[model samples]
Target: MQGIIDRQLDVLIYPEIGMDPMSVQLASLRLAPVQVATWGHPETTGLPTIDYYLSAEELEPPRAQENYTEQLITLPNLGCFYRPWGGEAIRLDLGKLGIDPRSPLLLCPGMPFKYARQHDWVFAEIARRLGRCQFVFFIPEVTNLAEALRRRLEAVFAQYGLNFDEYVIFIPWLNGPAFDGLLERADVFLDTIGFSGFNTAMQAVEQGSPIVTREGRFLRGRLASGILKRIGLQELIAGSEEDYISLAVKLIRDGEYRDRVRKRIETERHVLFEDMAPIRALENFLAKVAN
Candidate 1:
């Protein structure tokens, strides 16, 4: 088999989790002088050749950092890596989605079946509590493997007597203009906890949708909490299942609190997108490694 020729590469950056060991082994053998870095927290590769592990301010120091042998370089709070839409773009048309904008409540379930984030029960429970309000779910097309796993998830939903066809309103995945349109339609984005929704949660917040997240253990749980706190939305971070439910209920029922969070997010949107501190730090680190 052919090998990685070191002369062709200067640096290697792994963006997501789950790296193949063979790739690491091959890279180490040929790319010795080349720098390698990992981002998005998959714990460690246990490879001696990896030069650095990249993290964010949300990740607690010495914990995620301590577990890995590579030097840890922390990225400044980039808010969330979501594309932002201008304030003028936020539309108030829940009616088109078969929902009333004034309808006391709306639940934004951003869970994908592959991650075992079966929040069907939580949605149903919230619906039961809210009574008159509506719960909206974004149903994405499941991969074949995800579909197989979804059967078990469906059973859990059925046990609660919640039918997917009845509760979930389909919102096709959008990009560019369409994606902005979808974000403008929702009020609050409910984050998943069993495994958290990292990218989606940030996108929701960026588009002026307030995010309500439940804290969990390790990387997944801490991500949204970390981002919200950094952005001064700490009040929106819910710590338990009951807290999740209560916050959802309060955000819907209490007009004052809901308005406060909504306005705060709107005020912070520009600061989040234009902030260059994180970008500068990342560039500086990259330049140092490249040198």
Candidate 2:
């Protein structure tokens, strides 16, 4: 940027500005005449000349302005563009995974770092509310992190008077196809709090797996909510922590409601898969920024 940034470049976009020396130096340098940020970091860069912070309309909270310093540019009905990295969606038999065909399964899949301490109690409380239920969580990639999360959950469950060994099941991460298969069979997808999952939520929505989400004030926390909102599944999006618990429980207890939501999701899910409006919004933003 120090060498190439000049009057020739119309805009220089920083996808995410982490707390790193290089990003700070680059953002502080005003490398391009028009510098911008995006939803990657979900926070302000705080650099005076960093012109804009771009986010999708569906993913941003109403009071989003208070969270950022740059001029916020929101695009319509957009958040993530998901694609199959590898492997086709497979149909896995529950019997093979030691899962009973008749027992209900709740899938909680995400990174270890995204799992908050409070979430452990949430899971425990859910288990306490619904007896004779199984909560399945995907093992994190890192061995140590995976074990740490497992231990934390175990302790929390015990504290809540629920035996973790009897109620929780941990499945090691698998390839995309198999993972999708897991979603295909699961009853509900429990979203991560504070830091939501984008691609993971998309995959769950695509598979018609009912997800329970608590929308946050920040864009990062609203990633999955955007997907649910765009798909016309607002009923699945929880407004509060208690609402989240009720929604998840309802998805399990109310079979008819679950079926209605599942059917609606199956029919309305197409709209979220294809959206070209963001591209047009980008063109307009660039035209405006160029001037």
lDDT of 2: 0.82
lDDT of 2 at 209: 89
lDDT of 1 by residue, 1-291 (tens): 143453456666666435566555564553635445555544665667777877766744346666667787777774234445544443536666665666553545554542444554666577667665655655566545445434655565577666644444444444555455566565557777655666676666766677788876555466667767767888888877788888888887777887788788877656556567767887888788877
lDDT of each: 0.62, 0.82
Q: What tens digits encode model 2's per-residue C-alpha lDDT throughout 90-182?
A: 999877776666767888888777888876788888788878678877776577877888999999998988889878877788788999889
Q: Highest lDDT among the candidates is held by which one?
A: 2
**Against the true structure, whose TM-score is highest?**
2
Cα RMSD of all models vs. native, in order, equals 4.0, 2.4
- Candidate 2: segments with Cα more than 4 A from true spot: 1-8, 19-25, 79-88, 98-100
lDDT of 1 at 70: 74
